[model samples]
Target: MLDLRSQAAATRRAADRVGGLTHHLTLAAAATLESVARSQLRKAQVDPVLELASNASTAEINEARRRRSVRRGQDVYLPSWREAAVGLPNLFLRSALFSVCSAREVLVDETIATQGDTVITMTGVQLWNYDRRMFAACLNYYRDDRPLSSSAEHPWVKVSLWQLAQDLKVSYGANVHKAMRESLIRLNAAHLRIRVKRQDVPMPRLIDVAFDDGYLGRDTPAPLLRGSDTVAFRVLDSMANLFGPSDWSAISDTALHERSGLSSWLTGYYSTHAGPFKLAVAALHQYSGSICELREFRRRLKNALLALEGEDIPTDCRIASPEISLLL
Candidate 1:
């Protein structure tokens, strides 16, 4: 009987030891699976759009949610890293929509360029490099305000003229207010058209290109004169589409503000190209809509190239008889 009891006790001890061993094995297996899951998460590529949405403030998130329901997926938001940059359309930068010169001539279906089967045309008062700068400032404000995203049907922003002058790095005064008013009018008045022909298609398709519809003042009449007054700037659906994810380039505000006139235009032009090649001076002159003679433009081009280099942009000007080209 004593031997039987001792054997039974030994068996129970061994069973307990086995149970404990099984428990430890289970824990080890669970730990291994958890570690693998963590490693996989670390290796995964995070979606930038989702990350941007996640990092927004609570108010912004709520506002986005509210707007999402109202606009149905029209979320116009930029990543935090792009705060120092201004987003502009590649088509606008590539073409002479904003001419390098400050000529106020009215253009009616003026052909800007022809790329293969695509022909770009512009109408209304000529836009200059300064107008480009003002447009940039307006875009910056629109982004900052985080207004309710509007569809290609309707898009607008209510802005202050005084604040716009500050954005342009100019003093807020009568002259500055007058200039801002004129720029706003010009941007609203300008119209662009891009016609593309496909070999398989019989007719060319025209892309939508109403840039801006003009400004409406709150208390005063259209094109408000008071620097402190607010104006409703209508950004057409076509213009808003230019700010779409694939169509725009982020231009450095510092580089753009530091330069003016032709140099500034060059800065924006090159920002759109990832690998810039040698471009003929004649081509650039036509693209810039410069009123200067070819010889005079050559001198200005050299200076513009130097100015770009000063802003840490490398350039090589190739001068040959009967032809001049530049590589950036």
Candidate 2:
């Protein structure tokens, strides 16, 4: 309890600092976005060309065949911000969905579903879920200062200025919100020469590191963690000091199994690395401590697995969860 209390305090401090920055950055983005919208509207009114014309048509996608067919010194060049701006209309529609987050709502229309009057039925559970995801993004970026992966899937639903005030109904214990804050701060720091539907606009932009790293356009994923040698060494040194360990053996099995201990520590630590996540999973390996925790955790995971049974959730997709755990 004391540890959680301290964590709550520290998390609050971390969140406040990031959230303060995020608030200002988001305000700035709102202004910039309004200007961009007006500019886009003007362009649309003036230009009749929609989609790419024969003269302007670049390759629509990065294809293996296309890669093999490119001529020497004439590789296909896409507008730098190819898909970063693709989600604007979708984002605008989703904003309306978030606007209606009331306790009276039952089932959430998480996806916009269609382009019509988007009224999402927000449940308490879904609201809490959205809140947690936002808190995670803020903390993930601010305190952890980590790069985000596509898997991270930080929510981009910007609550309008009025809606934001309402969304602040809950305070503290908010990882997702912290991540949102950090992501916003990062976005506000970068300028993108975006070509949305063939018009150039230099705007402050936010993109998932996957997109920013050229995952979609370039097709190869980029590293999600960035740090200098000194920073990396300091992180290692900090982990050693915090857990009072240099190696796996030094961390007691019991200390590891305690959710408040190593496992929790590594959930934030080595968050992007399969190896450290493996180590954390191994720490849970010998845990025969309680049937209830195992059952609850396993049941939740099983349900999640079932949802993705026919979906592409991994590299090879041949192995199941426990089998993957064995590899861990």
Candidate 3:
């Protein structure tokens, strides 16, 4: 009887937490949409559409207009991290890499990734969630620009750490600053080897094309980062190619901020293709961040699917766990 009562209380608490999160996410999504609409309106040279004649269709027309405006004004481009090639959620840890929360240095010549015919190796370094955010931020920064050739001076992009923290919905603190610095170190020290079918591109480390201004070494200065500090980094040839607009994915800021990293990655991947996409449960596990064991992951995935149903968010995808299919 005591066990039963404990389970019931736990269930109620979980329900309450989910409800609160859902409400907060809903409000955030609405605010983002409103901001986007206002920005579009200000940028418009003239009224977007004819004032519709019938009052009955006015709501429908406005909704349609809003959808079109969002597509036009608020599109954020992201580079594709396809699972078959690079591995899904490209920077996350698999069971083979390290413990879920550990920051231990990976040994040199470690096989960090094995996708299709490609096998990527890395040195002793840890890639954390903050590193993932930093990379995404950099990619988004240069999304609209053309990738420069090998000879051109690398384009330097300057961004304030505070603004980046806000965009990522991460708290700004000394630890955050340290995390950012560590991310740069890990990324710079990493290497990649790509082999597709029978062909191979020369393997290259990320550092070949990217590096910070002057903060990598210990002698740089104390408080290596600050809210007001602006860091400028140049994107070189290979780096530009890495972030180049080949096949791209789109993930909304609200989705990234509100959902788990796995969910956000799944959303981005699904957004790339039209669904009712069918796949096995194993593939879903592999593609999403490999955090939880299968049983727990399935439970979490089911809840995500249920919560998404009939929600007013932008995704057209509907997920059902029993069938293991996503209908978009």
Candidate 4:
């Protein structure tokens, strides 16, 4: 009994040490983020367009000069002050079925069979992708310190469909237009109620919200939305808090546009950490956007790991089988 008690005491001490370390790390990270925020705000005082134009190639400068006489320190392109940020809940990031492309009501709750008005449901995949796209663009705009305009109704951030397509790295076509239109409708229509587990209780209700004001047009693309030949869209005021001082991760727009769903998941997983992480295959499968059987999951995950070899994942971090460790 004495020996058992000593062992238990040792375990408790170790856990306490780990907890203290975690707390310290969290404080350090918070301090770093605060410093970054201050620096970004300071940098915002300068005209970012001049920085871009200064770095442009001679040919590019000549083209801009031909269009409109380019001055040494004058702004070439107007900086977008519109901040279109979306704060996604942990539930939405981890397990929400926002990427189901079909129009059918996606069942979010595992225990519940039929989705009633109370049960959360995602509209489609386009909205899911749009959420990430807009979030990234908003972060970029914030980082660039774009000048805010006097538009009240379209306040958060205004982006044209063509620019959005370019950001998404997809060629604009009829299908793209249709998808954009339908996604705007679905995003505006989506209603969600999130429930989270707390130490005080088994489950605590977080927030009940809906996405609103998706597009800036009537039925079709406006002649010139935001001075561009594409449909204009704005971030909802409700989603504005997502841009506040919160946990944010830097996601590569290139990876997001180029990689497969599973590859993208791996990239995100790696971005969350600076070193190796040991996660179970089951957990990875759950987090991966790939909805497939165990065999198929293994196959795809292996391919994703393989694809990451030359990029972020170290060559030594190769996975020979299902039960393997990954280091990025």
Q: Among these predicted structures, which one has the highest TM-score?
A: 1
Which lDDT tens digits does candidate 4 get at residues 133-229?
Answer: 4444433543332322223433454555666666566766545655555555555444443222211111211111122323344554543233243
lDDT of 1 by residue, 1-328 (tens): 3343455445555455566777566555555555665566555523222223434665664454322211124454532215667777666776777788888999887887522344576777888877888877866754544543345455556657677777887878666665777787777766666643221211111121222223344333434456666655544323443333344577777655666778777777766666644677777787777879998988998877655554344332111221224321
**How do the residues 21-61 of candidate 2 rate in per-residue lDDT, one tens digit apiece?**
77566555555555665665665443211123234333442
Is 3 or 4 the stronger prediction by lDDT? 3
RMSD of 1: 18.0
Count of steric clashes across candidates, in order: 0, 18, 1, 1
Clashing pairs in 4: 87-242
Q: Which stretches of candidate 4 lie over 4 Å from their true place?
A: 1-105, 108-131, 134-156, 195-230, 236-246, 311-328
Give each model a TM-score.
Answer: 0.61, 0.20, 0.54, 0.49
Per-residue lDDT, model 2, residue 100, is 21
lDDT of each: 0.58, 0.27, 0.46, 0.42
- Residue pairs in clash, model 1: none
Model 1 misplaced regions, further than 4 Å:
1-81, 114-117, 144-156, 196-225, 243-246, 311-328
Return the lDDT, model 2, position 263.
Answer: 25
The order by descending lDDT is 1, 3, 4, 2
